[model samples]
Target: MRKRYLITFGIVLFILVIDQVIKFWIKTSFAFDDPSVPLIGEWLQLNFVENQGMAFGTQLGGGMWGKLTLSIFRVVMIGAIIYYILKQIKKPDVKLEFLIVSAMVLAGAAGNLFDSMFYDFIFRDYFDPCISYNQVEGSGIFSECSYFGYTEMVEVRHRGFLFGNVVDMFQFNVIWPSWVPWLGGGQVFPAIWNVADFAISCGMILVLLRQKIYFPKEKTSKE
Candidate 1:
């Protein structure tokens, strides 16, 4: 039991650290118009982008309210997953693989949740060229600022807690062929995602692939 606990903690910690490190590096070093850095030829590249809502750049709509609701939902889900893991850990028949995957999912959720809770406050100096604003003193209202060159931009106004955008950098540079119906010359996977998103996806996929092993069917009395 102690070994299982340690393994779960280690996996979650390792994933969280790697995910946050990659996100922080990309957020601080990359600019909006920077060219993508190819990792494996032109297939995979590092392209910086941010999303205000869910994974794969999906928006929940309703603007600020939507962001708040999504963040709250993530918190609730994380808590529930933790509870489930704890209960399962005490069960003699619980599979270790299940626990491992669950930990990865938890870590991924936490990594993104951390960004939503604090990135805006921490990365205020990372300016966005699209909307220039002059923040009103003591009030959160931001007035438009005069446009100059993109180089001479002011720090972005903070968006309060649970309102920061999630940083995404990795992208698959595959584009659909022009002959493809209704999907010509578009990226096969248009979404730019980060390490946290990758971890969550991999964990869920593994669980699905090995569901029977992780969850064995109980034999009936007659059988």
Candidate 2:
């Protein structure tokens, strides 16, 4: 049990730290909606964008209440997953893989939760300022900088508390054939995401890909 706890918590902390580092870099170094800088010659790019709603930059509803609801939902889901993992870990034959996946999920959720809950008070927009508000402040580590041609142009209106925006910065410029459905000759997987989002997706995808192994069926006595 001690070993399991250490491994699980370690994974979560490692992911959370690295995810925050990347997000902090993005928030302070680049301008908003700036042209995607090619990391792998158009294949992979770093495009900074803030998601105000769900993963992959999908919006749920408009206004503060909508965002509040989304944040609450995330909190509940994270709590449920953590509770389930804790209970399962107490079992003698708990699956290590499942535990790792759960840890990853928990880390990802917590990472995004941090942004949703406190980023507004910790960081300010460098390229774009709040159009509606006259002024705002940032107290984060990289809250001020001049790298990558970044200028403290406009401070975005502070959303406050559980209304902060999720920072995302990875973009894959996937080229597809002209015959390929709606993606014809356009970038595939265009949704810009962050390290935390990637971690969550990876964990969930692994579970789906190996569901049979993680969840085995019991044999009947008659059989």
Q: lDDT by residue for model 2 over 15-78, one digit each (tens)?
A: 9999999998888888774788998887889988787777787766645666788899999998
User: CA lDDT of each candidate?
Assistant: 0.81, 0.79
Clashes of 1: 0
Which residue pairs clash in candidate 1? none
Q: What lDDT would candidate 1 get against the real structure?
A: 0.81
Worst 10 residues of 1 by lDDT: 132-141
Which residue runs does candidate 2 get wrong by more than 4 Å? 124-158
TM-score of 1: 0.87
Among all candidates shown, the one with the greatest lDDT: 1
TM per model? 0.87, 0.84
